[model samples]
Target: MRTWIRGLVLATLLLPAFPACGQGGDGTRPSPSIERPSVPSASRRLTLDEAQAWHGRHPRLLLAADDVAALRARRATQPYDRIAEMLLRRADEHMALAPADVGKAALAGPDPMPHVLQRLAMAGLLTGQRDYSRKAIAMLAALGEQGYPRRDRSVAGAGDLAVGLALAYDWTYEFMTAAEQRTIQRQLAALATEIEASMSPDGGTFGKLAAQEGMAGHHAVALGGGGLGLMALALRGEVNYLQSNAWQTTAEACLRAYYRDAFGSDGAGIEGFELTLRALGAALPCTIAMRRMDGVDLASATALGSVPAWAAYELLPGPSTLPAGESGGGLGSQDAMALMFAACPDNAAHAWLYDVTHGSRGRASFGRAAAGDASFAGPGAGDVMTLLAYPGERADAGPPALPLGKQFPSAGLAYFRSGWGDPAGDAVVAFRCLPRPHLGRWHLDVNQFTFHACGWGWAIDSGPGWEAADGEPTLTPTVGVAAHNLFQMDGREAAAPCGRTLAFVDDKAGWGLVVGDGSHAMGVTTFRRYLAVGKRDGRPRYVVVIDEIDPAPAGQAANGPQNPATAGEPPVHQYRHFLHTGAGNRVDLSGRVATLTTPDGGTGQFAVVSPPEATLKVAEIRTHAMGTHPRIEAQHATAGRFYFVAVLVPRAAGDERPIAVRPEGRPGPAIAFRVTADGVTDRVCVLTTPEARPPNGFGKARHRLQLSRGDLTQSLLFDLEEPGHDAPSAPDSAPGATPTPAP
Candidate 1:
């Protein structure tokens, strides 16, 4: 139990975070120290008759016999070449099963090595087999004689059994024996002395990798200190009981200060981009197997090797994803697209998201494989790093300059797309204003927003991956605030959000905008939210929301007009306004306008133009709704001063053109809209005033605010206001933001 690393912290390269001695829970704690027993001694590095006399040599360990003969001379039909034949048929059906009998898989569990026997002992010693390398060296000598089980010892659950028993005892060191490689090095030095007495003084880590508030400890320090620096770089060579440079310089200086306080540098995934692609499926394969076996360049650590093409060009062209906070699904992305093109294979947006979700068979993939730690859901045994760390390139499958608008201003996450990756759904608009003490799994969805067109999804936020459950994990309810969109008062909800984001416009060719204030997480005196997306009669494609609620000064009103000396304050709250659909939507509503119908067969329409005596309701979800599915709710309440607008149009059925919303001039976000379908008369504009500078053809040269079919002018930037959680740790900055931490 050595583990030091104080001087020249691994000769500099990002080290900082992992000092955390102890704090995150739920993984059953119990360790302050004590536990180390193993006895074995013998050596001849790589024996067994030199592994049958270097069998079919060519320095192959993690794929390389010409990279497995160019992946068995590929037949590239794409789906990333059939995920290289489903990772060599999941290491040939995990070397044809038959291993678990070590006291009967340790009587069902207690650290009996379960990541499918480290993918069939590294797919049977990288395909040479030998009884799957002596049954994974007899389950690492029966898990070091059952001593390495404090219930699978945690240090991020012993990073998949210490990186699959340090890659099956360093690629079957010449095929075992020498008392089977010293009985797997005395069970990896007694599981690295129970992970340095269970890390704490700041490194075995805790939580608050907060994206807005809490519950995300940078994927448990990327799978327990990145499986202790990829099992100390496969136990690089020998030494008195081995300590591989003090656990690779103290787990690369606590993952270079937890990738700048939890994976930042604007690649968003601050713990929400689906746990930032499932913690980069254990941080891009321990930062590409410690940069291809020990060069250790964390590719600028938090640059996170172009975060899966920055999550397929700013969070995959819509249609669901941003299950914020505790994250659950979609973007399960084929083991983070084979660990980011096998660690940046010249990346063309990670080979265009491995040609869009690996040749979709309606994406069900062997029925969610075994889910657990999502590296492209099992069955191919959790994407064996897309065929032993894919190097065989596809490089530029073309197209990637990406950005009609991009803003990760330190994970508050903002986006705007009209084209880039456009399959029609290029209008992938988004918003999440994250500010004040909000994250720790906060789904109190402050200034939420989402929209997709052409690429379908009209308006979504009913996140948490349709209530998870396929193989395991059924996490959908990101807790209360009714699965997101915003505004809920009397019934409570926004207890302490913080919300910011005031102006952003990428009106490059048409319109794209974002404006939010969420007035101190909804206590309300003026909680603005103006969202807009373009194209209407050039062929439907539209979205416009402009809620402006103000009612607090001793409030009172069912419809405005009579104040009578601020009469006995206190009873005028009720704000309700959430929008979640997809329980196979078919909604109808009417009076204030609703009209939806998707579930594959499309059609849309939404309306409710202001406090003209507000009204509208659709309701459904809430049997303890954790996230979504079973929602159609529209709601619009009025108890005092008012202003609210909603309009989403995609209307296709027989091209009937007639959409509406009107009430322009003074009321917070004074609104306007007018569409007349094919005959032409589009004038969609969501302009709120009392501005403070911002609105000059939406930034960057030559583009003016007046684009054709209207709908995208955008406004409301009260100097980007953000201060509530009452000093919830100072927020409100826009030129590359980042000042969070308040859950």
Candidate 2:
């Protein structure tokens, strides 16, 4: 891909820091500007001649020169990357072609001008060559004349410029004549100015490299802009840079803030894949250049997990598995991570690089660059997955393979995924709760959870998708139950005028919190709910239950409401199912048994009996006041090879009652199971009476069966192992096999 740059932007640095927000106890604010460390003497500095010679000797850096020539000879018979292989092969061809006499019309297509110049400068500095410097300068001049196209506000602009300057200065500073050096500096000055203007007024630059939504965009913009901005100024003498504290303070403040907020403590970028690459790439160069100037180490604040390997680990698709997307063209998250790791394998970030690149999938495409086409030449068997498969190097340690997917749901009905490395291993729990969309009016999902993982997350909040139809923010997680799987009255997604997250707590080792109530609460409907995580003896388990008591049933109720200003209810309904996004064995939900349907159509019932507490009252009302659509979906599938999971809805002991079964037929006991294990489990029962006095007072009858369980394993007449159609007839008291009268 051609490196694109727009215009010779430039600007002076600004500074401002009043109240010292640092260790400088003196009243005045410390310089927010990053101080670049002085380079060791001239003998150690890389010269232009040295850099160029290094490139000529290292053929791999040219991507695939020999391969391209060979591919061209057999173009008709070779594959797509062969063509991309060829384009890269002759990058020198394009570089030598020369722009049609300076005044010519601006050429269209992916311009390789900036890339060629940058590459040449790197080569020149490494080899200490004069010719490379001259060639690179010529390309830079052409690039400046074209006036780079405007990029949607981005962090890349500043970062790229900073890198370009550093390389250029490092290689050519000593070799160039007085006139040449002046010209080069002038060009850099202009670029610096333009980047400064586009930088966010709050302190970073803005430019969209990928889709302009989600955590990815924000991370890219901040780190990209911050790193680049710091480099440009740090390289220029600090005395020549801004003296005001505000400008310096703002830049420094944002650099740390963005790195911390977006990247997280684990070094994981908030947005997945693409953005993580951009942020890390930009941050790396900036970190290097800044440290070269200043003594500060950003790595101390950022962790090892924040590197490209973290991204790669998440991207790997196990052997024989198709890539995650329905369409395979988009960059695989793992591939991007591998590439970045190869480019920047410093000791601090080496571990992640080694672990990811060593994975089985990564081994297949090591040392391979994007061939401008899908289905390119893959990696060697051993080198393919080696963390250092980038030809010239190798990362230590074998690649780490993470478990593709494993999930668990919380009490407030919030869902979470655990044991990324293995389905059975203990894992971090995050929230998955969303707000209702009322009459098309949008809001962020509340009661959302954020998982804390090994400095990296295999699964994360998908983040808000502004473009999504419901207008519910994706991936912006909050803590609490008001906006989760549990019920909320009058349909409030945000809960209150300015929703706030209530108190949340979890004993790190024992039970953990799935939801809380800190956010605002609205309307005439609300429930006090709690969930606990504990091991029944040694078996880990989660228990959840919600208690809702509606004092005034008179208020309007809707299935989902859209507008709050109005006085009506919205039409919202709740349903649960275990969704399958990938190819996996199917599970059947028939009567009280959940049977796993293998890849072939054969059936194996894994769980046994129990019915759920079904309340039609909660489903009947529809709110139109807020144009919100409220809904809940449950997705079920086989768990742990085989295990029977019986779910119950009857209130624990205290609320047992003889609940009426409607219309004469249906599973009546308040218990249900999503079995994924062997052995039979019995379904037990009890009953409950209305809370307040009914029409006939406390004696009024309502036949609701409270549920309980018994041993169903190793039983003959009631074997759960039998398919639903083959299972023995139920006892006369049970609903389906016997005659049961309606209330």
Best-fitting candidate, measured by lDDT?
1
Question: Which stretches of candidate 2 lie above 4 Å from their native place?
Answer: 1-90, 93-120, 123-135, 150-180, 198-217, 220-227, 230-251, 264-268, 272-274, 302-367, 371-580, 583-674, 677-743
Alpha carbon RMSD to native, model 2: 16.8
- Candidate 2 global CA lDDT score: 0.31
Cα distance off (Å), candidate 2, residue 431: 4.6
Per-residue lDDT, model 1, residue 190, is 62
Name model 1 segments beyond 4 Å from true: 1-161, 170-174, 177-180, 187-218, 225-270, 274-276, 280-355, 358-384, 388-426, 431-445, 448-540, 545-743
The positional error of residue 413 in candidate 2, measured at the CA in angstroms, is 16
Pick out the ten consecutive residues of candidate 1 with the lowest summed lDDT: 5-14
For candidate 1, the per-residue lDDT at 150 reads 28
